[model samples]
Target: MLTHLSIKNFAIVRLLDIEFSSHSTAITGETGAGKSISIDALGLCLGERAESNMVRKGADKAEVTATFSVKENQSAQAWLQAQDLEDEDHLCIIRRVVSKEGRSRAWINGIPATLQQLKAFGALIVNIHGQHAHQELLKPESQRAMLDESGHHDAILANVKKQSHEYNKLLKHLQSLLNEEQQRIDRKQLLQYQLQELDEFELGIDEFPHLEAEFKKLSHSQALLEDSQICLFNLYESEQGTALSIVDDALDKLSELVEHDPTLSAVTTLLSEAQINIQEAAEELRHYVERLEIDPLRMQQTENRYGKAMELARKHTVMPEMLAAHHQALKEEHAALEQQDNDLASMNENLDILKSSYFESAAKLHSARVKVANKLSKQVTEQLHKMNMPHATFSIEVVSNGEEKINSHGTDEVRFLLAANKGIEADSIEKVASGGELSRIGLALQVLTNKQSATLMFDEVDVGISGATASVVGQLLRDLGERNQVICVTHLPQVAAKAHQQMLVTKFSDKDITETHMQPLSQEQRIEELARLLAGDKITDSALENAKGLLQIQQENLI
Candidate 1:
């Protein structure tokens, strides 16, 4: 429950501080007396959006602080501990500051926090029903959400959500497989073309060097043969006095002289050995020259083979030696493409399984929603009658137009219908319910669904009713306060008199500056304030008597 609130330099409020400890508190003030401003200031501490226009005329900034005693609010306490922002004494203080320049900052338990964090923590500690909550009651989504909350459909909804998530994942995987299949087709066509070209060339690893060598030898055969002949002649096969013949003639002369002188015998033996070596060299050169022939056919064959390999290498932008590696890579790619059909089939099967699971879960959720919708409509309609809207007929419509696609929210559409007056047929709540009816209906739903111990703050909930209707609204608020702390801002004396604690908001001019003041009313002060509410600027004796009687009746009932 909110224990204290402080506002400074906010709108028409200069400085205000008040403490509260009651099951039911009412804030009463004249129109334009800044009654709503106090709630707005509290909202800022709860992380509502802020603007520079909310700042006081002469102030540079506005600040608000709300303190909650969370001794009974375990959820809020646990959240503070989880966020590492818990105070030592289990007290939660939320503060918000807005500068004239539209800059805003927030803190929870004196620790800095983001606006979203503040809002989340605030939700755990209190539920503030703005004066405009009726506007939200008209939204179909809001109606569905409220129904789900009241129905306790969390378990079924979780199943639906899980199935939907997996279904979407399967859908994404199927799309990826389809995209890959198309890509594989393109890749396979390219790889097949490359492999066909490679097959036509009939290339091999290490073959480039051998082919080049053969081509070189065959292309220069005539030149090689001519050079070999000149070399042999110079060495021993020359026509002009062959070297072998010269050596032989010298040896014959030496042989004749060797008989005359025995020392000459060694010279004859040396000449004989030289002649034999020169003759053998001449014979070997003749054989080598015979083997060297000018064959244009063999040369052309080698040139064409080597030329095709080189041309293919250039076309593929690879070295002739690297062509074999490129061909191996293409083969591996083709093998993957061959396996694509199997992979795509498996993905499609999984996609079908996911769809079935999602539809099954969605069907269960839809059934649960329909069952709860009838009970919700009956209960809310009863609550509306209790709020003095006796003729108000409320119902939750759950319907499906065939088998709708599975969604996180399930397949059924939910709407709230209403008839605000007797003899009126129920219609869509948004189209038929007036603002006053909307407010009561919204309160009815809230009162029925809210079981949290957090305080409930209603800002001017009795906006369109007076007299008996206003009194019933007051009693409704009072009854709600019996279970949880409740604060209501109102202009009705009946509502104000019903509060266990009453606070009055009054605006007055001081030195040409308008200032707003708030203070908890004493017993006599409460009666005077109630009288003022009844008589407006003129508190007559009769109005005072009426205020006295209203307060007495509320007190007697409390007893």
Candidate 2:
């Protein structure tokens, strides 16, 4: 509930501070007295658009602050906690400031906030029903929303919305796949042919390097055999100065001098070891020469294998060593395309399941709305009767579109129909009802359907109502105030008299400035204000007595 409002340089309000209680409060004033200035300021604080014209003359900026007590408002508390804007003592303060240039800024709990955040948080605590709300009530969407609210169909509507979203998402994917069907077929066929070629080749990992080496060895086999024979002859088979014979001659000369000098003995030992190494090396060369042979057939076979590997590498646009990896990559791509085909095959069945689920939930919602519509129609008609339209017949028509149309709300179209007089056919409210009748019906719906907000503000919603009907509207608001804080701006004395508290708005103007002031009225002041509202500019003795009687009656009724 709103606990206080402070306005500065806002419209005609120069500086005003008004405190509110948790009950019905009536704001009354003469024409052009700026009765709605406070409401307008409160609207700005609730995140309404701000304009430069709202600022008072000569003021640089306009500011409005609204304070709410959220001790019992769990939704508001949760919102504040989620926003990290929670304050101690269960208090929520929203302030909006507009510069003279039409720039606006907002704060929640002293932290900077965006307008959307303020609007989101404001929705949980306050519901402002403007004087022209009846105009909005004419919309079919509004009618449907009211019906849904009355039925408490949030969970069911959510299910239907979820199902619809998923159905549309899958349907779009299926359409895309169908559109690309030919392209996918062509690509798949190409991939299949390429993969078949690669499969037949069956290139082994690291086999290309070994094949190249073997081809080189086979192609040079004759040259290799010739070189080995020459090396063998020089190392051991040469009869003149073979390496073994030279080493043997050196060892014999060193042995003959060993007895003359001990140093010669060490030299002889080294020479003997050298001779043994030379003999072994020569024998190994002889064996290699004997084994060396050239074969033309094996050389041709190796050359062909290596050439084929190189040709395939060029055809596949890969290095010879990378053919195996490239083959693996192509296989992976083909596998993914195949999986897409699989998904496309099963998508229609999935879409059908989703469509069925959506329709089922929509059907349940339609049933619930129909049931609630009947109850709501009856209750609103009863309220209309009390609001002075005794002959009014109200009904809510809920029609389903079946599978022809669907939306996030559901498949049901809700219409509010009314016949203001007897023997008149009930028709659409917008086509048949007058302005005053629309206001009454709109009020009835508001009174019946609004159950969430902690505070309800009716800004002259009783505009076309007066006399006994006005009194009934006041009483209805008073009843609502018993459960939630209610604020009403009205020119009707009967409505003002029924309030637990009252405030008077008066405009004062001088040569240079016009200011609007609002003050809470005392018991005597309330009677005086009510008398003025009843009798116009003059408050006669009878008007005073009538105002007192009205208050007296309201007090007795409360008991």
Candidate 3:
């Protein structure tokens, strides 16, 4: 429901602000008045395709903003949440600015929105129809979508659609494997070669560091042996008293004194332990000095093995430490290839199951739609009777063209059919001959599909309609307004009479500027405006009387 519209520099509108009600609003004015201009500005704010021509003649740009009451629009609220937009209760503001240079900018709830986002939200908020058929009527998908909306099957269709896609994706991988069996066989051969190369030269994670440490020790063997031999000679075999032999001589002398003094016994025990430690150190040093032989061939062999391992590491694009993991990978790949055929067969079976599952789900959804279509046709027919469209047959039929098959939406083609008079063959709603007939059909669709509290705008809906038929259109509009807001730009006084509020769109021209303005009618103003609509350009006493009587009748209806 649109709460307000503010437009500036849009055509001859210049600046216009209008507040709306939750009831029927009929806007009437002279032929060149700004009613249509107001609609165009509102359309721009609704994210319609815009052009630089929309900008007023000397103005650099045009801006249009609409504030809507959208408390019931859950989908729109969800969209706003995703875009991080502010939603204050139910009010959503959409604004668009079109420059004279042809660039256009848009906003949603004060947060900037792309033209695409504005367009999407616009579809849910308002349905505007005028002298021309809606552009969405051209596409079969749009047609099907509208029909699904008529069926009220969005939630069920959404679930079925999601499950179907999951089932399809789940099955596609295995089917691909089944179809690539020959390729898998070739892949298996490559894996076998890699496996053999890795297995023949097994490597361990810690082996390289261990071997390198050992090699380093062996390379420095001569220097290490010399250092050890010199230290041993200084401690036990040097002329400075051969420390180990001195300890041994002291122990021998202390033993002799122990027989005479008890303190000498303790000194003799300590000297004996020192002599034993010196003997062990001398024996280790002598062995190291004897075995310190550098074998060049062994050193060369170790260097070659290290180089080979490093080269292999570089070849495999991994460090030498990862060789064990590389070997394991080759083993796994070889095993996988060995069982490739069985895996492929399993994949094929799974794909088949998925295909079957999707088809079953789709078929069930299609059946549900068929039932919904018949119900919709009957309900619409029942509604037509109230609109004085007795004997006016209506239907929604499904027709498949073996096309438009994608995995997302199910595969059923549907279209609306209509017949305006008795004994007439029902045909596409677009094929109706009379503008009045089209008006009534459009009215019926709008009334039947009033699932939301959205604002429905009709520009010149009462065109080519008058007499009792025009009165019926007015009644229909009024009833539509009872549940949802109806804003119609009408020429007929009968239609205008039904409005809970009437607005007069008038032109105000000046020497420098010619502009259009709209104002809600004061009580006396309504009488004059209705008279103008009733009697055309000239005012007469009988026309005023008729306009006043119409107002009185409408007032009574309100009572």
- lDDT for 369 (candidate 2): 95
What local distance difference test score does each model get? 0.84, 0.88, 0.79
lDDT of 2 by residue, 391-410 (tens): 99999999999898556888
Please name the candidate that would achieve the greatest lDDT relative to the true structure.
Answer: 2
lDDT of 3: 0.79
Clashing residue pairs, backbone N/CA/C < 3 A, model 1: none
The TM-score ranking, best first, is 2, 1, 3
- Give the candidates in order of lDDT, highest first: 2, 1, 3
Q: Of the pair 1 and 2, which is ahead by lDDT? A: 2
Assess candidate 2 and give its TM-score to the true structure. 0.79
Q: Which of candidates 1 and 2 reaches a greater TM-score?
A: 2
TM-score for all predictions? 0.74, 0.79, 0.72
Q: How close is candidate 3 to the true structure, as a TM-score?
A: 0.72
- What range of 10 consecutive residues in model 3 has the weakest lDDT sum? 399-408
Candidate 1 C-alpha lDDT tens digits along 1-559 = 8999999999989999989765989998888888887778888888889999989998999999989888888998889899999888889888999999989999888888999898888788878888878887777778778888888779988988988888887777768768787787888898899889887777777788899899899888887888878877876866787777788889888888878888988888888888888778878888999888788888999999989888888988998878777777777878877776677788688877877877777777778888888887888889788878888889888886445575688877788999878899988988887777777777787788775678888888877778887888888888888878988889899888888899988899878799999999999999899999999899999999999999999889978
- Window of ten residues with lowest summed lDDT in model 1: 399-408
